[model samples]
Target: MNDNFENLFENSEYSKTIKKGQLIEASVIEITDDHAVLNAGLKSESFVGLNQFKNPGGEIEIEVGDSVKVVIEEIENGDGTTRLSRQKAKNETTWSNIIRAMNEDEIIEGHIQTRVKGGFTVLIDQINAFLPGSLVDVRPVRDTQYLEGTVSEFKIIKAERKTNNIVVSRKGALQGDSLENKSEIISKLTEGQIIEGIVKNLTDYGAFIDLGGLDGLLHITDIAWKKIKHPSEILSMADKVKVKIISIDREKFRVSLGLKQLDEDPWKKIISNYEIGNKIDCMISNITDYGLFVEIEEGIEGLVHVSEINWTNSNPNPYKIANIGDQVTVMILDIDNEKRRVSLGIKQCKDNPWDSFANNNNIGDKITGKIKSITDFGIFVELDGEIDGLIHISDISWNNEDNIDLSQYKKSDEIESSILAIEAKRQRISLGIKQLNKDVFMEFNQSNSKGSIVKGIISEVDEKNALVLIENEIKGILNISEVSRDKVEDMRTVFKQNDEIEAKIIGSDKKNRTLKLSIKAKEEKEEREAIDSYKADEKESISKTSLGELLKSKFKKD
Candidate 1:
């Protein structure tokens, strides 16, 4: 019984030699290549790293047989040796110091090693801590690259032993500075005061002005006397600007400032210097659809409407009359000091051409002019002044083969035209050089009667009728009735404009300027009847079919 008891006691004593995570006082017994054997007052010596022999300062403080507290990291494994950690025990003491510093709310000095996504990692003693970028400085920093390798003071905002995380805020320290700066700024700040300040930050709508210690909002609207598109247009980061304090909120420490108020208003002094009907020279600033905006003085602009540009022209383009940067003299038609607007006129600065034209011309005076334009029914001629006269096609001739060729006349063509009529109230004049010549019908009246046969060219052909121009002042109309006694197909295929043909004048009225001529009627009676029958059949065929069916038939043939 005694031997069995001794055997159990021996086994129990062997088992009590060492265990994992056991705190023990140990002595450095021997040093090897990478590890050291420490005597922990047990039967087995524990193995520790060689690096544990030296302090963080690179000094080997522990000597052989020197005692130190150690933590058992592992028990014997396959190699049969106990693992020990001296540094782990020393870390416990460091943690205690950190906790004490945190509780006391003390500022810790640390070196920032590397940057992470949101912040930089700082080495505080033997621990890794996070220093957020927002808390890095007194103001927000755009680039955090300069923080690497920099040593800074921070207050521990969060620390946890289990998680091994410590969050330090340099912003809290910066906030202290901001408060001090703010106090300094407010000491000298007041409403209705102007001072210089640095632009700290720019927002989409405005900028925050740093007036030494406090930040005041400088709205984009207040930054310029004129309209601005964005806050960045006038203010940029760190820009020094003169600002006027418009208001202050003592409770919230809010400040309102204006930048444009420093400049003098030009409108206030502009009206006193100028008056209506005064002619002033100015440069065309901008041309718009409605008018032209001209700058008459510095910061003072006026409008010259399209109607005011030229009295004689209608629907005149502002671009044609006034180009950008063109120097022009204008008369001030009206001015409204309260509305800050000046009405200007370009034509008022010059003489009215129409007024002078009306005074010089009358309805009956015969004058020579040049042909300006020719239309289907009349010829327009430019008279002695800027006036234009129209001679109707009816007045061009009194008989066939005596009609004038107006197409031979062109714009600015020099010719002799008679002044047939004029209306000054309506600002119109009637001129006819053709009428001044001997009347063709009266000259031929004695020889050719109402049934006279004449030869002329087909000067104009239309869907309705054809016109024959003969003598220099005579024209005859061949109506659709004359083109065909009954019906006719496409006129394009039969006769084109300017074709010459012979036609008998069936009737004439000299006073009313009317003439009747015919071509198909001059054909044989049988041929005319056959053509009329064919035309009637073609018209009936077209009327019977829908347009879509006709087009489909045509497309199919193609």
Candidate 2:
């Protein structure tokens, strides 16, 4: 060997110890169109493909003196050249990262390259790993092509060196990051902080607002100062709204928001603007079976219960009287500040019809009305001012000792009656059709009480009893036994309809309007009178005979 060659070998890394399957640090010496020359502290420089030094962006990133890790494939090939592999060197490092991430539950970065069977191919460092479709995101993704060539963090769930198998979850890494970010966000939140955000989603009870990357709940009750049925009533999806933070729970990552807090609470000004008996014109926002909910102002409302809807009607139907969005005048009946409640009355806004009627009319005044309805107990007559007067069944007729056929009157039938009573506060008006004429019932009842002998005409006869008309208006019931002082098995044989018969008044029922008559009692009373008369006449005759006999004896002695 020459002196120059001997000195070169002594100073070169080739003599320092080089072997195949060994990783060593190398530096770029020169670059060409297709390849780069690297020096691994060896006597001879080796060539590497330029594509190996190119970054994922397809840009040539190599420069002179750039240190790289390369594995020796052969220290000396048949051509007497050093052979090294860059990809193999990177594979060893990639395995180390994957094993560490799996064992320590750490996150690693990867580039999603392409779609594969049942998953995507992720390049972690330089090693290929399987990323399942379900692991791409926190939620299911219909299209994963958008993730290609993008760098994302991942958690290695499984790894096997023998088969070179590795599995990673992007969702797991994202969830971990979300938890940390959520904690930071919640910790910084202060209650009552007004924030502008976009509405993310709406449910029946609330809406979820996106405060930057964090989500907060806006309950339906807090969405507006007025009552609402759902969150959608005031907000929609993706609507931009300013909300106030009502509450925050850092540990649970929960935040309560209120949209109405952005505006002045209308209830705070309610007392200043309204008081009991204050009449306000407003629109009916909602109508339920029980009441009408009217808006006093924006975000302020009052309830008018069915009872307060009218003054004359005992059971006023809310739906029948009003509808949603109807303009109406209501008087404030009560106010509850703490509960944010107001009791209202539709009838209080105007003069009560009952009171007006009472003031305008007097008892016994003649009234013309149309029958509004007929019930079992009474007939409702619609009188003046749409007010109704009840004509009870008992007051409907003066001659219904038998019965008054209610079918004679119908709805919208015009009739005349006299006002019997007026109870304004109780919301009742009593009328009597019989009062338009004389009350023969009262006179007949007074004149012929119990034990009074009265002549009556038989109006009806049945197997059990007979009906007889007294004073041509009142009728009394005469049982079969009362017809005669005998065991009468069949009342039909003893009496018939339209037959004239005299009887004594035995009993009376004012509620049922019945008078019991008895022919047997009348006959017994007549017999007693005749016996008393006969006894008085017989005693007078005896006294006269005794006086005549004494006078005749005294005349014979003279």
Candidate 3:
């Protein structure tokens, strides 16, 4: 009995030695409504709140005889019960685990609870840890509200047990994972390798793609076979796309991706698909000041220049004739495989007006039309089929003395003309109004000949010559040398307009329609006739009288 009493005193001494803030391993002995009795190697039984042994969902987490870690808050109280806490013990263990994770470079899982001034409060095993805004992700997070209630792994970068300060980074953990993924991707990457990626960002020149954890570039030109103004036209942010690796630079860590490479190059079979002078229907994809871009097929386009829009209309504006998304017929004017250029013509698909007019008519064929426009040099007549023929100013009238007033002939005036020439290549048609009637110069040549005496009135008197009108229609000229058989200084002084005169034609050119008249020839002919008359009268008188009587009569008269 004495040995038992000595052991009891030893147990009491041990309970007195138990101090506050001490972590001790204990086993749950009994459970009640409000308290859990625990055996912690102390003389007296310790009690912990039953709430500490329950999970957040109000279920019992610890049963009887279950091992638990706790802190001694009091050794001996007035009620002779040892006070203990389970939360303090859990906090101490969490700090120890965090320090070990930091030393081992391990990642810890945490839930973002709330936002703070410069960072977010994350609950790591019931202990609050700081997550800076800059380190939330690999990229900047514009909205932190999305992170609430999200559980993510993080790396403990800063830890101070005394101050209870801990800082964690989600970006650091992501970068660590990226390094491992990047190495594997780089080793396996090769040209012409097909892969899938997400569109991360966009720029003017290209788009950045996230291939797993690696970033690659998809240039604007490589997005599609056709032209694109920006990357957003073909792709949007966070869109999943399949691409082909066109090139790779390991030293610079750059990868060039292409979406068009997976499909066939349209230019490879362009020559076989199209040919010169072949007609085909196309859709207008784009319009510019110089031309229209026509789509022959998907990713295949041809240029229809402004010059090729029509045959008759020069300087055709593309905007006035067609707009975007219009269907039109075109003929392939040219094809260049090396340059990947196809020249198309909208006019070639239609019948050429000049060729049609030339084939139906011949020179000197008379046709009637209305004057469409008038210029200083000529008038444009619109004939059948909307074709225009030009009548030059010189061909408008037959009389050289009269100048036709073009202003008198207004637009839409009906006029008759004869086709003179047709230039199919130049798309020009020449018409003459004078050709509708017989040529007056031809008739003049048939009636008059050289050295013929003609009488007419002077129509024009100049220093060089005196123009005379014969038959009131034909014109003749009297040179200065032929004016009255004298050396005249000026023909105008000797003759005036409308003066009636008789002259002999000295020269005539039927082809050139020129008549040369001389007054000197007429005067010389009259003199010769008078001399012949006098000789005849003298001869008759001599025959009637004798030589002696004739001489005596002549001497008496003298």
Candidate 4:
């Protein structure tokens, strides 16, 4: 028996020397409920905990005659057994893999185990590695809990077996994958290609979409056919959407995407769908100081300018008449297809009161209306059917006076007037209240003649002349030299308002409606008549009496 044992020991695989902390290949010799026996080139069979050979779910993964790599923790023990560890073996192998990955610039898979100070701890196989917060992902992670227990690929940036230090980067791996994806996507990308993507972020000018590992810009204008102030109005973060590729820059890795290009342009057939003067119902979409924007159809809108809101009001307030979300009827006045603009008018759908009024009335037609508004220059009269006619201050009376106050014609006061003119294009009506009466100058011209005596009252007096009101409302002028047949410095001193006086008309201008009166000529004519009468009396007395009786009367008078 002794001779047979020596022969077996000399040829056995464990006859070679083995040391602790050394890795060696082993084979499972036996397995039990609590322990596993492994032949690891040792003098005696090594025993390890059975749990080491079991998976996380407590299921045995190793059986008899199965091969595995193990680390020797003890060469010999007092119990006549060698100590071996499967976990230690796995940890050493994991460190070797990580170091190799770092050298070869390869990626390894790992699970984020837990968050630690300044970073997170990741478990790769059975070894723990450090993952800095900055290297976790391409974007900053607000909550580290989200990454816990999640399996992700990582790039080993550093590895040290002496100090048991290892560092990995998720961001580096993602960046490498992104570069590959970007290059491939750019090579295959063509204009007009439809693709799906997730909305990554939104900005004032546009939205960024993520197509797998690449990012593209979706401009705000391409979001829809209608006008939008921002991209958030139509899309939100992380929304999935289908978009068309508009352009691509290979060198810059820039892509432009469009969502509206997938649909037909609404303005392409606008002319065929709508015509001038066609009435349509629309909803107010927006309001501005200049006009109202009404949407006639989806993605199609027209402008109802302030001037087109009403016939009478040239400067109408669009907000006062309509608001956002209000429905209204409008007429298509004009359309420019190339510009994609439609000029709409709310009043065009209704009866134009000015046009109707002009058709019914002619020049010199008498009409009665209420004063709608009064100003220093004119008064606006509201006629029938909401038509307004302007009665200028000069047309209010026969006299042309600059200081004619229009305050007397209050708003809503009844007044009679005649239409003098109509400007259809400008939507203006000229009216005259004084035109209802005959012109006073025409009557005065028929009765008065030059060099005729007339009586008048001083209506206005100035330094140069006195304005006199003659018969039939005729106005006359008397110069200062003609006042009282005497030289006068100022006519205002010789004449007072409403003073009655007699004078001779020296000049009469029928066209100008002016009569020139002279008091000096009248006084001179009366003086000459008195002298002639005295001469006639003296001649008769002399003829009746005699030369001697006349001499004696002269001597007595002396």
Candidate 5:
């Protein structure tokens, strides 16, 4: 009874010594899927959650008889059992290490677990630490999702043991590491050292590759000989790639890498493979508003400008001309090796319609086509061979040159026209609808000569002259002074509109393409012709009478 009382008193003393939240070492006595029983010199074994005994991969890491540190959350609750937490014990130790790191300015390893408000929560030695957005990297990073679940080094910037608050800066750690190894990495790098690296970050202009101790830039242009707008097109974060060191700027600590430098430059063989004016078949790879990019070969593309897509139409739509992946024939207009550019022409591969039309047709030849478009200035007619001919308003009719009625001509109206001009070099075809019929002026000129009398109706009368519509389609002007060789004050008084008048074509005025007619000259010419005819008849009668008298005398003498 005496030994039992002593044992109870010793047990009470041990229980008093075991305070709540005190981290203590314990040995695992039994372990199951849900709980682990640990003995920590207590009245009863404490049960620990089996989940806390698991490693990061979720496998149970502790077994029976293994010593593990645990924290006592409750020494004695309503029941007789003691509650213990394995994770809390680990966190306490980790917090102490974090505080030491902050005081000593030391770097530690961490795993970015998830994104939280204003920053991320990083797991450092089983304790959650705050990582601000600004301190995630040495430079600002818009996308930090790639860092999730990734292990990185960080420096403890702030730590509070009472509140269990810890803050870390990955940028500080990264900057320190870079400065320590930058000189060593730069020393070994040569002008053309081929090395392997991981794609650390991507930007529009290039990608930064992690070369063990430093970051090297792989420009978009050096990614491939062909064009790429962004580095993300070919590379992703953490992708391993082999590149050649193109250049090194040790003063600025910048390294330039090139992926294409490993391969032979295809442009070096361009002279043997291609030349200017060389016709070849290609596939359209891309289409833009300005032009189409055609793939000549691997890593080589040539631009076919909109102007070079067709022969007749200037500034044709690239989408209408061809689509992506369409096979087309193009002529190599130029090959600039120095610039690594090629000027290709789609129109040069086909026959020029202007040259073809000029060779097949001539001026004054009648052409039949449907009017494609009608405007006030002209009519664009769709002629043979998909060519277009323009009939200006002035060439639409014979007499309505000044005032034209566009309502008469409609789109898709079939009409017959004569080719007035064909400028092959300019790729212009001038058509005339009026030229298909006989010209009124030419008809009058061919039928009548100078001084010929012609009859016409006065269509318009003014003080200066009377406008006569000769032959319905031809117009002539008769001035007031030439009306009757008399002083004519007003032409309207002498010649009324719609009145029949006879006039002589005294001369031609080619400036206005009109004939100068005179009524006085016509009347005078008629009088002179009548007098001359009378005199000729009288002479013939007198000669006949003289001959008869001489013959009668001769007959009487005989």
Candidate 6:
């Protein structure tokens, strides 16, 4: 009994020394409707509110004999017990662990609990730590929602022990890889090194190639020798391509790539297979204004110029002559391997007509022809064969002007002409019809003076004149004024055509082949005098007859 009393007095002294607001470890003894009795030694038994121990649904979170660390607030409330809180004790322990982690700059492993605007919340040991958006990935992640519930390594970027705040960086891990992996890939890449890569991203100028652990730029210009409008025309994302490294910068880890250099140049083998004057068949691959380009073989092209299609005819428009897919045979006239030019021709396959014409005909020969066509300058007359001649307007007639209408001479009019000139090289023949007739004026001028008299038949008559065909070839115009000098009012009354009359040449123009004739003055004067003499004789004879009759009658009466 003495030991029990000593123990009670000792406990009372310890409880008096333990003040309110002191932390104590206690076990829940009993749970009632509104309170839970907790045993905290040396202090009085603590009563925790049921609101703190029970969940909102009225179920007890802490059962009897469950040890809990709590804070005491009241010593007695008419029940010789103290008030305690378990939630406050748990909050203090959570804050103490978070503050220690922040001060040491330690990365605490956590699960992503939820997401925020710029980042996600990581539950690190029941403390929410901020993982920024930029620090979420080694590169960059567009959607943070994908990162929720995903575990990754990160570095602590911001930490404050006082505020218990922490921030982590995943980008720092990505930057560290650049310094370590970039040099390793570059040094192993040599010139002419063939490597496999994946097309990561496509751009207008180039593509970003991922060479396993490193990245290299693949420029669009190096994709192919042939023209490509865009990078997507040749490459696409995630496409596997084998590329040869042309150059490498070990310091910067830059690589230059070439796809075409792996193959042989097609032009090098093209020169040996063909030569000039080689008659080859080719397809018309392209049609241009100046020529048609033909592909004789793969990557080997030759040009057939517009002039070389047919030498006889001017180049027809390409649409009329050849289509896009037409196959043609062209003669190779020239080949220059160094210049990469092949000149071809179509006319070289046929015999030239001008060369054949030069061998057949000569000048000054008589050619019988029929008028085939007429132009402004001359008439085209075709001979028996394919031969034709031109009779210029000046060579048609000696007394005729070139302005004379030629429609009267229709096609198939037979005419004899002397071949004036023959240009066989030029494939031309010049003929003259007037040369077939004797030049009477030329002959007359050579034999006689300019004023010599000439006689001919009047062959043509007009309103005020007549044309005398002097010696069949030469002609002279008899104007109405020159035909009579007796004030002849009209031309038809005085002189009749085809009458056998003679006249002197008052004037002559040998070069012009013209003569002037007159008959009115002498013929009119002689006619008047003869008429007067006849009238006088008739009157005298009548008087004599009357006198004789009177004498005869008197003699009969005696």
> Of the candidates shown, which would achieve the greatest TM-score relative to the real structure?
5
Give TM per candidate: 0.43, 0.57, 0.60, 0.60, 0.63, 0.44
Residue-level lDDT of model 1, residues 1-558, one tens digit each, is 256654574478545665677667888888777777898655467788778777546767777778888888877666755677988877776677666655444567778889897888988765789887777887888988887988788766656688888877787555653445656767688888998998755555677776765668888878875445688877766689999999987666679899877887766666677888899999988888899988887557899988888755646888776689999999999888777788999988876655565577665566667777888787887754465678777666543324667667687777665666656546566666557677766676556666566788888887777878867546788877677665876566678888988776777766656567877555544476799999999988888777779889999999
Give candidate 1's error at residue 448 in angstroms: 17
Worst 10 residues of 3 by lDDT: 1-10
C-alpha root-mean-square deviation, each candidate: 26.6, 25.2, 28.7, 27.1, 23.6, 32.5
Candidate with maximal lDDT: 5
> What's the residue-level lDDT of 78 in candidate 4?
80
Give the lDDT of residue 179 in candidate 1: 48
Off by more than 4 A, model 6: 1-261, 364-374, 379-401, 408-451, 457-467, 477-558
The lDDT for every candidate, in the order shown, is 0.74, 0.84, 0.84, 0.84, 0.85, 0.70
**Worst-scoring 10-residue span by lDDT in model 4:** 1-10
* Alpha-carbon shift of residue 56 in model 5 (angstroms): 34
Give lDDT tens digits, candidate 3, residues 488-539: 8998888888999998888875444568888999788778889999999999
lDDT of 5 by residue, 240-277 (tens): 99999999999767899999888887776667789898
- What TM-score should be assigned to candidate 1? 0.43
Better of 5 and 6 by TM-score: 5
Report residue 97 deviation for candidate 3 (angstroms): 43
Candidate 6 lDDT at 49 equals 76
Q: Candidate 4 at 151: error in angstroms?
A: 20
Please list all clashing residue pairs in model 4, or write none if there are none. Answer: none
